[model samples]
Target: MIVSGMSGSGKSVALNTLEDLGFYCVDNLPADLLPEFVRRVMRGEDRPEKLAVGLDVRSGGDLGVIPDVLSEVGGLGLDPKLLFFDAEDDVLLRRYADTRRRHPLSHLGLALADAIALERQALKPLRQIADVVLDTSALNVHKLRRLVITEFGLGEASTLSLLFESFAYRRGVPPDADFVFDARCLPNPHWDARLRPLSGRDKDVSDYLEAQPDVVQFAGEIAQFLDTWLPRLQSDTRSYVTVAFGCTGGRHRSVYLAERLARHARERGWAEVAVHHRELD
Candidate 1:
């Protein structure tokens, strides 16, 4: 598996998490060396069963070389998977804040937000070719761990879910999402204090909000959009796709919504869906 993501979006944490879960993890590796790296592993030069590596901007102009690298390894009889973790600007900023680490581009003395935006641009190619896109803006390590376990077939939700979550800044985002979103334009759930703390999972919250014509209308629109969107993702012949949910605090509406959405998708005959509340806690 190739663990790719933005510099501050838990790429390091996920590397360690994968190792804890038994992946022979390699970090910030030279992208040009991947094909040979696998060669070494297959020859018993490294751990065999589970292997993961980190790839991102540190590779410089060679950053775009990964897809070729992965393609080269394809005929080797391994169905290699590319897993990426990406989050919104603010969430990434918060993570950087909590960790107090410097962005790889900080040497330019550029504002953190701008640096992240630029980095996203640099990583767009990989995102387009990725088998999975995890938006981690609101996902916490615990939620992320659960997602990793569930989606990867290592947790209680054994069926495995290639789950992905979309979120909004006006709304909270998920802390454990493999994918995340910034939907500030959708609507704002923060105006109402009562609904502010309640997630989409609560009956009262759903009822109160759905009672509003706008909420019902928007829900239908988003649901329809995803129905078309998700199937395209699944048809890609890739391993899996996981979609997550997010709101302003991840505590109230988004969490509740994600749970219900997961259930809805499951009932509709989508294998099994795993739900995670990234910012709920």
Candidate 2:
């Protein structure tokens, strides 16, 4: 696999995850050297079955040659899949500010935003040919790592992975969510002093929410909708789907719905159900 992406878009994290999954990983290799490197690996007496290479604007050489190099590698009996990671411009800008890292193109006398724009334009061809283009604007490092593992390291490549996430509407809906459900209409556990400090994972909170008729009906309807549509989505060859639930505080209601839906998905024999509470995790 070839990993290429904008800087600060989690290429390092993806490479680390791939390494943990037993891939021999190399980072920032020049695009021009890829073909020769593959040839050397093929000639080695003990070649690794899995390999991952990272490339980006930092990789010196003509980026335009990448496509031909990939084709050349394929001709040598190696199937290379390109994975491009991206984020919204604002997200990338914020990431750069948070990390206090210089952009690779900053030395060329370009401002941070200009450097990012330049990198994006330079990487356009590679993105166009990418087998998968992941927008990481809404994903934390953990979520991105989980996504990589689900898509690549899972034993069965064909099985679809489902992620159920809960967030506060105040923080905004997750940009990557396939479906977003508002849970603000449900009972507010925050009003009850006893359950105020507890999250939806707590027995008291769960029992409280489960006791409400409106909550039960809402959950049931969401479950039925998923049951009716998820298989059709899977049949369409989607590798992953994210379902998000949002409420006012993101503590009780949203988390409970996410957890409940994950359990429901698992009970229905979906092998890859993961639950994440944004506020909690």
Candidate 3:
């Protein structure tokens, strides 16, 4: 695993999470040395089964040559997964100010903001080739760790980690979603006076939705679609796949479908199914 990102964008935290997961962790290795290091690990009998390497702007000109080096690593029969961490410039600036650490480029007489921009530009090639791009603007260390574990934890040895998140359409779909199903077409439980105060998890709301033929059919078709195609995705070497269900309010229809889908996926032998009710939270 290769983890590279903007400076102060949680690269260290991500590497630490991988370390906790039993990966052989290396930080700030020069791009030129990556293939040699992985070659050694591949040849070693006592090395950890998984490896996590952290790279950042400090590598300077070496960053530009990473793509070729990574290609060479792949040539050696290692499926190197690259994960890039990204955050908004404002958030990065705030983090630096809170920590009172000087930017790595401060010696070049560049302001912090300029240095951040330069770092992003330098890292663009790596980001474009990343297998997974995690936006850390809204995540703290703990949440980021959970996300890392959720995507790359033990269950990933066989199947993809499945996540179902319910969100309101007005709030926008999650950027990480692989498939988005709109539950707004189903009957609106919010319209009922009795169910207005209840969420999809409530028995009353579930019953109301369960009574609707269209709702049942919609959910069934979704499950069937995933049943047929998820294996295909897993075969593609994806570590994680997130399917988001969205409704107008996200409290009723979307939440109901997300929970139902998660149950169905788990029943179908998906070992790592997770559900998130965004509006409920």
Those runs of model 1 whose alpha carbons end farther than 4 Å from true positions after fitting are: 45-47, 158-281
TM-score of each: 0.55, 0.56, 0.55
**Model 1 compared with the native: what TM-score?**
0.55
Clashes by residue pair, model 3: none
**lDDT by residue for model 3 over 120-219, one digit each (tens)?**
9989989998999999999755456567887765434555777788889997887778999998888999999999999999999999999999999999
The TM-score between candidate 3 and the true structure equals 0.55
- Cα lDDT tens digits, model 1, 1-281, are 89888886767656765775678988878888888988888888445698898888876675787788898888777788888888888888886775467888888889999899889999988888889888777765545655666677754443334454444455444444544543333455567787666566677777776676666665566567767777776566433455565555555555555665666677677654544343332
Off by over 4 Å in 3: 155-281
Please say which candidate is ahead in lDDT: 2 or 3. 2
Compare candidates 2 and 3 on TM-score and give the better one.
Answer: 2
State each model's C-alpha RMSD to the native.
Answer: 12.3, 8.8, 11.8
By summed lDDT, the worst window of 10 consecutive residues in model 1 runs over 272-281
Candidate 2 contains a number of clashing pairs equal to 0
Predictions in order: lDDT: 0.68, 0.89, 0.85
Alpha-carbon lDDT of model 2:
0.89
